[model samples]
Target chain A: MKILVCIKQVPDLESRFKIAASGTWYAAEDLAWRLNEYDEYAVEEAVRLREASGEGELVVLSLGPERAGEAIRKALAMGADRGVHLLDPLSHDKDPRQIAGAIAEYARGEKFDVIFTGLQSQDRGSAQVGLLLAGLLALPAVTTIVAFSHEAGLVTVRRELEGGARAVVKVRLPALFTCQLGLNTPRYPTLPNIMKAKKKEVRTIAVTDLPQVAALVRTEKLAFPDKRGAGVVLEGATSEVADRLIAILKEKTTVLK
Target chain B: MKVLLVGEYRDGKILPSTYETVAFARKLGAAAALFLVADPSDLPRFAGKLYLAAAQQCGEYNPEGHLALLLQAVQAEEPDFIVFLHSAYGWDLAPRLALALDLPQISEVVALAEGAFVVPACNGKLRRTLRPLGQRAVLTLQSGAFNADGEPAGTPQVAPLTWAGSAVVELVGYEAASRGAVDLSRAEIIVSAGRGIGKPENLALIEGLATVLGGEVGASRPVVDAGWAPHERQVGSTGQTVAPKLYIACGISGAVQHLAGMKKSGFVVAINTDGDAPIGEVADVLVVADLKQFVPLLTGKLGGV
Candidate 1:
């Protein structure tokens, strides 16, 4: 069995973000960057899939600037057989669907039983990639998958839905699953794997080689957002505070009951 | 030109939100039709043809599988545009469908206009008009993006068809939830407390504000992890999906996870002492003063008291 995992390099979750002077996005300078937290789950799931079956190869893929290779290395360290980096320096403002196209184009030539991605990226939170990639690949797409297993060309997965609901589904081969965090605790890189990943073949490819640019949407500009102030807390008991808060909310708008 | 609208139903009943989508579809074109991918008897009414899928539950709605179905469906109808509610099912499938069909897709659009649609882009920094590349475009309308168009449109003719036996997916089991549940998607207002509020006991103060707003209270992941709020009340990737009219984030640092759930509110007000907090960046109206000092002052000035 062959598996492919999509990963992203994002700012560490704990970074302090301040919007640029323009009201579009945050300033990236001097901020610490790292692997997307949820994507870590994707890499872990792929690794586990290979280990459980004991015969599959997991190739990890990441797209971003040159710095993105740092993220692919982490997945390689975690034991993926190989890594691919698609260069895109102007990813910040491009359409996510366009990026999805680039990924689909590269993987179109290869055959993989399954593809995995995080449910959503930590930075954008658009939650569109895995599904969009599935569409582009003309394959099945599953979101918020918390668990998975393989049996006779069929894939079984557990999906988390709204209101604490859960569903177990069985899908055929060549499917897409977007992972939720906490689905599995990712393993740390072992000393042997760490050293071995350094020798693993790391492939570098350009965006132009893929079929993504022709369909890509151009971005004009990305600005930072507006600023906000602090809030006030009401004094007294819950009842009094509830009453007082309700009154204040009512005064501001007509939503009051 | 006619538009194709997808109607969703579950457990032999139509969703209240699907009707809103139907209404939105009707105004978009004269020959609009909703492909009711379930039992026809379960729905309220439709203004156009209700095309039923062979299986009962839209065959578990895998984006690629559904796109395959949609590609065939669109070829038959020749719809000028396709629209749907941006539900979990839609989110997973819509953009993929757009890419599959090689048509640009726009999401989180509260309103539609001629050729181009008005959508909130990049955390609501600005609302931009998005135009698709093809003549026939696909779109996922924001949940509750528009109010109901009108009464049950004239009973649409139900057109049922057999499934192609190619969905390649099966729903093994589902854990049903209780009714009268707090669905954040339809909530009109929400009050959320974050790390700045301190302590679970302080939630009462936050709940006070929720009671006034006639809405539910929410919390950031840290607050929920800290047991200050139930996991159900948490907003973000791991929590509920809420698009209330007015959303107040009290003392929250505004992580992306938290924003994912509620950033689409009609009006967002953030109360944080830190001028550089992430919440402050996207909030339409911001109060930079201390949450503790101002929360009561605003509550005290309320007239209903």
Candidate 2:
């Protein structure tokens, strides 16, 4: 009944982002960091599964810079038994293959029954690592699962599809799942739990110590997307704004006319 | 370079994105072939070779089974690249095929640059150009990014492949989304709400505006996930891709997923407190105001229509 959950630290969605000087990624300084929203749901689901089983160990893992350890600690506070941090200063530069290869290298020997990860990270948004890790390990995998149930070593999951459709899939243990939004409500760490989590052991492994995998994809440049057009902005009193909007809709588009 | 396009077959028909993938391959100006894992019934008239695998052995949408068939196709065709639509099927299968073949993989490519691929990141605020270092790669094109127009008019050579692998996962069934009554795709006008609406009760303001405008109500993923709106009314990558005549987004800070659904609307309007919201990038009109006061006033003004 052992379970492993992979989490990532990303810039808070509300943070104002600035392009770095290199023009390959966002600036690292003056940014607030938090656990990726989707990964939080994965941690909550793993915590609930371990609690229901009443005996199994729940391990949390993260592959990112030093700040990612904070995300692991948050998961620990939420209810994981331990944490594993694959520390890399330049993790943001690594592509999905390199990231998944590092995780696969660490988890190869650990025979966990199930592995969980967010459907995608908020920053990269590639949505490739979990399935890539599963492929590297030769384990069956499902993505964007919103509903999950387990019994007798068989796991059934309802994965989200386009247009709000759900596909039910069943796979045996030694599998992987990418948790999506609306999967569950994550719990906030209370004071006592936060204090207790301070004692939890978090093993650190330098990503350099792991087998190096060459990045297949490289970022050539990063920039703000081109604006579609110069949009007319309306402001002032609500009544005046409403009047202007109506006039524009009638003149600019056919829907109102 | 040679290319392979994987077509997604679901619920007895091929998806439109399959042809869109063809449009992508044609953009590369390379020899291409199409692959599908289904019974040979009225196949598409691809200009290149078409590879078909029986659904009985592949089990229609099983990752391992499809991977096995695709692997065989790759061995035979020796394509330099494989392409798929960024649909649920492609999102699930492309990475598996990449890792199994030990090739680099890129997902959700929105545009093709001179020699790189452009992808949206950070909720569509940023775009990154990615170049593959490997000679071969797997790519999933963003849906609707490529248009299938003026398709080839000739039939393709059919090549049947066999799958001998065992299934690793079972396809149990599918649960239809609740409240299928609202079809936003057919609506001429859509008035959508987002988290800025504040609470479930605030949905009334959105509905009132929609009614006054003679349009259907739409919602962002957050609004739907919060249970403020039904799944059918959700508009986004995972919800619905719509191209209405007029799309008025009230309080919706457009996430990339949400923008993907409605970016094709003829005219876009966004009302949000933050003028810099991503929705403003695609909007024709940006109204910077609190939705609480603005929506009611707008609805009252439009009531005479």
Candidate 3:
């Protein structure tokens, strides 16, 4: 059995985001990058599945620039057997279709039993690439999968829905599933595993070599959210603040009185 | 601009966001029309055109079949803009249809003004204003971003669409997210906590305040994902939608998903340390202070032990 997990490196969620001088994207200087939170779950699930099966090769895939290689190495350290880096210079801002097309083109011939990706990237948050890749590959696709069990060429999964709903889907082998949060707690790599992961091979593929796809959308402008007028900050001790809050709630809102 | 509105339905009821999506599409100066793949009985009558495609296999929500049906509608109507509510149906089918038709896609649009859209990025830390470079585009409106139009205009021109395609993915079954011990949807007053509450132990403060106010406790996705709250008590795009008469938001930063669920409450009170949190926009009263200090103080003020 073979499993393919797709991951992307994103600016750490806690980082202070500033637009670049060009005014098109995030400032690259001094920004810390880490595996997307959802993608981390995907990698963890892939590793767990491989370990459960006990005989499959788990390959991690990422489409990004040189820095993304570091994320791939982390996934490898987590237990993936190998990594495939789809190297591209414009990794910071590739159209979802363009990215999906490149990945589908590369994976078409691999005939992996399953593929896993995050529900969406934290940075772009488009949440479309996985479904697009599924469409391109003509494979069954499930999104926002929170739990699943696999056996004998069949995968049964529970996908999240609005209003705390879960849909149980049963798909045949060779399907793609997008992992959501709460799927599993990712494992931390030990020192020995981290050292061994450095020796694992990450095959690099040039983005130019993949199928040509044009970007359907373009970024027009980037701007911060409009800052509202100064809110009335109730000051003084906690007792005073509580008095003021009660007064405001009773006078301005229906919470009191 | 001519717009095609993709309507979503589940279990024989048209999702409420469909009407709001029509209003949003209309705001873009497009003559919007509703494209329904399922039964239209649940959809309120509109003044615009209504296109129906009764595909037998599409009775259930499967992205693959929905995409094929939508592509057929796009080809037949030749509209410049296709609008869908940014729910599960839109999230699933829009990308594929956009890719198949070679059209630009704008996802999770919060506000639209004069062909330009406001979308949040960096986990709602920043908002970007974007315009599609092409004349044609597919757009998904974030839920609760627009108000549903209730005024009647005129009778709509109902038409049937011809669709023929097969879905690559088969529909198996669906299980609704379990309702927790307390039904948030029916709660008259809800006290919700966000990451701002600081720690799991702090939830006791929220529970105490809710208890004193005779309301139920709710939480944001991060709080629930942290295991401090159950998934059923979570409110947002993935969780329950509630319209309690009064909602007290403690330390919630108001991500779009979280706002989608509670935005319609009759009255809102936001307590947070950050003055600029998006929750301020919708809040009736914004109290800028640490929830840790304010919640306990307020709970004590309410005479809670």
Candidate 4:
């Protein structure tokens, strides 16, 4: 089976975010950007499935500006055979529906037996695109998939449901699933493959050249949070600790109300 | 411009988050409107319009679908600003909508100012200011972000949204790898374990206390990644964001992402061998001890279920 894994480039979760003085957006002046933390599970799952079957190819896809090539290259080094980078100047600003639109249009013209993506992007974190993409493709869609199985052209997956419930369902080939973390510990790109990824090909396309997207229904101003007044720490022992803390807690959340 | 609180409903029923979103949205405006989108339902009773869409379930009390519909309505009937609670479906739906709409979106918004939205970023330690370049913005509100106006700020008015196709792709089936625990968010008191529990078998001790507390058991990424626990139980950036009234973390060093999800939790008590562990940094109370000995003693004292 051929596999296509979707990934996104985002600001590193550890770095501070700042809106530009102009107020257009977070100042990207010096912030670090990398593959979304969750997409790694998507890329990793594709690789693992390929390794387990030992007779398949993994093609990774991303939609973004020039630096997105770096993200795609990382996927290639992680064991994907090659990459396709959809170049959109505002890829960083594109909505999940629009982004999913581009991916679905491209997939319609490609040859992949299955598709995968992180359950959600760390930054944009809208986990909808994966399921929406499946809907567009008219394939079985599963959300928060932590386990999977593929055999004899049929696919089975488990979706995390509310209140500790789950729904295990199986669909045939050509399905889209959002991979949650712990589905696999994605491997970092190896040194040898890291060098090879530079030489390998990455297909880039213009966003305008792709399918047309509806007018963005909304716009956003990205901002970081204000600091919490220095946190209050309670000094105490183990047993009475719960009792004291419970008092403070009851004083805090609306859960008690 | 007035603040708009977006909500998801099916068959004319509103979820609790809708009320929560409305209550929160009212904070940013002198008066606010709570809007619901679905197949023309009983929205007149709510504070705003009832936008209709193709027949389907909006949310499972956690509606990514309803959020999509709400975004569509937000587009059709633009608001000065929109607010949503950052639950699982909200987290999955809101950010990209903000991105698609090119609107400035702040997720995990814990505080709001006239020109600035105070959000927890880089996890919880760092907070930054967001000034919307546009006329409006969308925010995924974190629990306990603000004190919602106690008094109703807006009168009820019905706004109608006609049916239409969703721009978002559809998800056919939501099958899980395994059945995990239900709504980890609603658990009022949470007993969470980390990789420090040593082994899956060790979870029995944690479960013992969880039973006593009448709460659910949550885990850190390591344990979930190790397959000792389901992904649903994992509480952190990659896992669920829980704002339980009382959070008891055992044998876990707090990573930024892990703290991002739970730090808003009302009161946190941490137990770890290293008294200076990162999780201990913000904990309301620190119990420095080996969980191995502590768990048995704690459970013995609390007694069995």
lDDT by residue (B1-305, candidate 1, tens digit) is 78787666544556666776766765675477776556645655775676666445455544434566676677778887777776666666677667766776666556665766765543343344556665777777766556685667567676655544554667777765323355667778888898888777778877887776577888887686566777778787557778888898888877645776787777677777765566766576566656676666555544254
Compare candidates 1 and 2 on TM-score and give the better one: 2
The TM-score leader among the candidates is: 2
DockQ of 3: 0.51
Q: B159-270, model 4: which lDDT tens digit per residue?
A: 5444333323333444333335467888888999987789999998889878877788999877878888887788875568798888889888776557767987877878
Show the colliding residue pairs in model 2: none
User: Per-residue CA lDDT of candidate 3, range A79-193, in tens?
Assistant: 9999999999786667788899899989999988999999898878888889888878878888888897898988888877777677777788888899888887788989999
Query: Could you tell which candidate, 1 or 4, scores higher by DockQ?
Result: 1
Candidate 3 ranges beyond 4 A from true positions:
A30-32, A190-192, A206-212, A228-243, B40-44, B55-57, B151-156, B162-167, B186-188, B197-199, B271-276, B284-294, B301-305
- Over B124-236, each residue of candidate 2 has an lDDT whose tens digit, in order, gives 77889999997888999888888888854568788999877678898887887776777899999999999999999999999999988889999999888777888889999
Better of 2 and 3 by DockQ: 2
TM-score of chain A of each: 0.83, 0.94, 0.90, 0.83
In candidate 2, what fraction of native interface contacts survive?
Answer: 0.80
For each prediction, how big is the interface RMSD?
A: 7.6, 2.1, 2.8, 8.0
Error of 3 at A143 (Å): 1.8
Task: Report lDDT (Cα) of residue A145, candidate 2.
Answer: 94
Candidate of highest lDDT = 2
Better of 1 and 2 by DockQ: 2
What would the DockQ be for model 2?
Answer: 0.68
